[model samples]
Target: MSKPVILCVDDERIVLDSLRTQLAAAFGDAYIYEGAEDAEEALDLINDLNEEGISVILIISDWLMPGIRGDELLIQIHKNYPNVIKILLTGQADEVAIDRAQKQANLHRCLSKPWSEAHLLETIKSGLSKL
Candidate 1:
């Protein structure tokens, strides 16, 4: 079987690179890492990966991106792929949005932007532990 995937979505290429780099370093070859610049692209990627028989185990998305906001995106993803863990990484999401995602998306965690590598890894490990 293909390795499970961890997807990171952000409008900034630099942020995407940072997330992938840190994930690869911490996870080694244990999971496939994917990136999407926006919610529409993320959904398409998710569908494509699913069709390929690759499981998307986790998603870490930015809340302030253009197009679909992270909370809404996670809720939509949860409706279709309920078992996939969701994490919102943002510096700008309001409490209402965070709470909505927590309830509707079964969101695993919400980490602030300019995240620390240690905290990010810890969040991932914690989320993965429940799977």
Candidate 2:
């Protein structure tokens, strides 16, 4: 069976690269680290992974994107895959949006854009522990 996936969605290439590096460094090869530049692509990839029987354990997404916003994407994912842990990383997400994600998406945490690597790793570890 495939390892669980930890997906990151961000519009910025640099942000995705950073996530890839950090996640790999922290988690090693225990899980698959996937990235998508937009919500549509991420949704497609999630569906594909699901069909392939690869569990997606977590998603880290940016809030402001060109297409669907982060909260909306997480909410959609929650609708189909409630077990997946969701985290929103945003520089400018408002309280309303964060609240919506919390209620609708079971959002695990909301971290500010300039997130510390240590905090991010801790959040992921905490989320994994719950699973």
Which residue pairs of candidate 1 clash? none
> Which digits, one per residue and each the tens of the lDDT, describe model 1 over residues 28-124?
9999999999999999999999999999999999999998999999999999999999999999999999999999999999999889999999999
TM per candidate comes to 0.99, 0.99
**Native-referenced Cα lDDT, model 2:** 0.97
Flag regions of model 1 displaced more than 4 Å.
none
**Positional deviation of residue 127's Cα in model 1 after best superposition, in angstroms:** 0.3
lDDT tens readout by residue for model 2, 34-116: 99999999999999999999999999999999989999999999999999999999998999999999999999999998999
Which clashing pairs does model 2 show? none
User: In model 2, which regions exceed 4 Å deviation?
Assistant: none
Clash totals for all candidate models: 0, 0
